[model samples]
Target: MSGYCGASALNRFVNDLLFFRNRLPLHVAEFSSYGGDNFDEAVQYLELWIRYSLSCPVAKLSVTSHDKYQRWLLPKGLITSEHLTALQLTRVKTQDDLDFSSCVSLKHLKMTDCGIYCDRIMSPSLKRLMIAQCHFIGYARTQIYASNLILLLLVDCMGMTPLLVSMPYLVEAFIRLGYCNDFCKHSYEIGDCGDESCWGCQFYEDNYGNNNCILLHGLSSCTNLELTAATAPFIFRKDLTRCPVFSKLKTLLLNEWCITNNLGALICFLQHSPVLEKLIIQFEPPEIHERLVEIGGSYDLRKQSLVLKDLNVEVRCDDGDERVHKVLDVLGSYGLSPEKFKIQRPPKLTRARFDDTWTSGSFSFEQEI
Candidate 1:
């Protein structure tokens, strides 16, 4: 297919498959660009097909472009559609103050590398939301009012102001607040939002900083939370007005950066989460934390009192002395025996059928409920 006919052909294909005989029925629409001359025009025609096929409301819609520079602004007509159950967009730019009030069936929304200028996302039926490497623009804060959301994942997203989320139903979350290296440099190059002062800015004062108190407040209802090194610093501050009670948190995962440098914050979670059951300590490679000081974050270890239940801890095998003892001693004080802790190292084969030369001893920790 060539220029003008290629776009027309796409419309014809949709007409035959979805909007045939003027019948409007709910269906899935997936539009991916084919790296052609009319990539933008293809997207526009596809939107037209969606508008004309309103009677057949789309249940799931995924739209993407082949070129990163060519971004599609999500049409308002689709946002207000009553039958959209799942929507996924990549390499798109969203209009400011876009209203999704009419999205009655939207349950899952995912955006990757998109520019989001909207001030608020007020969806009542949205259940899961994921934003990765997306830019949140032009606001001091973006208010997310998804009262029904269950899972929220934000990974390496830049240019986001503080977030105020009303996710009463959130059960799990994964947050990595900043870029792994040179966040400001990369984020500013694309979004035009950062400046020379970015380098001198304090961790708590910057985009991915301590200003996330409200973000943490919104996630207080979650039962399982995972924090990367970037996001863990938000909880490391000793000046936190009051630690938000994680009344339902049961499982927590913190990376090597959090465990090695912020033992105080680790103790903070141990004190606040009354019923935490599983704590997984993920390890970074050997070169990451050699220059880092030991447990310098200002938190009161005196405030730590164990109210945990059957807590199982798994550690990554590293040749570090301080961070290792720091975790073990804390758990040991929580009444967990050394037998309950397992060090995860490289793969070692265990042969029960032919193990005549190697011998191992078994130990266990028994905690009565």
Candidate 2:
């Protein structure tokens, strides 16, 4: 139902749904509501509808609120559903401490453009979890516990990157941290930032002790993984010291952040992934005075062991040849032969074209080291 409908109409719709009490085992249920003249009443009706639908034992449920000014709290019943297998929430505000352990049968869960005010998300049966364009509003970092998760996509998420608990079955994951994330607010290079007052640095030091693995250890089992961030985030760089050996990883994709600090992070991954086959690097235009800022300690690439079958590098700037040469020089030092890699450059570069390169895989091979 559209938010344009008045409260009376909404109440009528709920009444109609209540009238059809025989409709048990609902295959799918979707509800949308934006701010209306009677906002509070609309919310009440929406909650009522949600509660009634849960009683029908919905297999799949999707709730979306288009009102940007306010976010509707998810009904408690939705969180504790036994029949819900798939759930998608958009523009909704979760409670202060959101937990989904009660969703025993839920397999797929996706949240987009939502406010996450919780400190942890715990689920046992979830196989696929995707959170995109969401804001995590809590002061402490959110921990994700989805032991059975096989696929995870966390794209453009803001506010302290969530810590991933071990998911031994995870096969694929794509994490792209946005510019508004907490780590991006700091100016100094991650890990090396000596500012005593910087919370970002302190948070990393305190949270990432010898035993704590912020991301890499949990993601070690994934066969295919993509790690991208706007303005180099600290989690990836900090986790490098304790980065678990990606024994199962075959394909890996990294962005400019990996090479920010003299290609140390890039080389570290190569050294760790013994059986890695294909590696793709997406290089953005370099700033005029953007010198390589050292974040992680340098690795001796001469001791590298992993031999990649194919390495694709796509440069998004016109003066990419020089940069590409520099990159090859570094890799060459690490014993990666010229024939193992290919370079691609589009005639006209745009963000859309750059993003499409991942799926298209159509390279001219005009520039090969």
lDDT leader: 2
Q: Which stretches of candidate 1 lie over 4 Å from their true place?
A: 1-21, 37-39, 180-212, 230-242, 260-262, 288-297, 307-309, 318-322, 346-369
Q: What TM-score does structure 1 among the candidates reach?
A: 0.74
1-369 in candidate 1: lDDT tens per residue?
A: 245256657656766765455664658777765455676656766566556545467788877765646777777545568878888877877776545568888888888888777767677888888777777763345567788888777767666443646567888777666633233322221122335455412332443223345466777788888765443343233223245777898877766544533465567667777888887776655565432233322555576577544788877656653466777886687688877787775233242111112111110000011
Clashes of each: 4, 0
Report RMSD (Å) for each prediction in the order shown: 9.6, 4.9
**Candidate 1 — which pairs collide?**
24-55, 24-56, 25-56, 204-210
**TM-score for every candidate vs. truth?**
0.74, 0.84
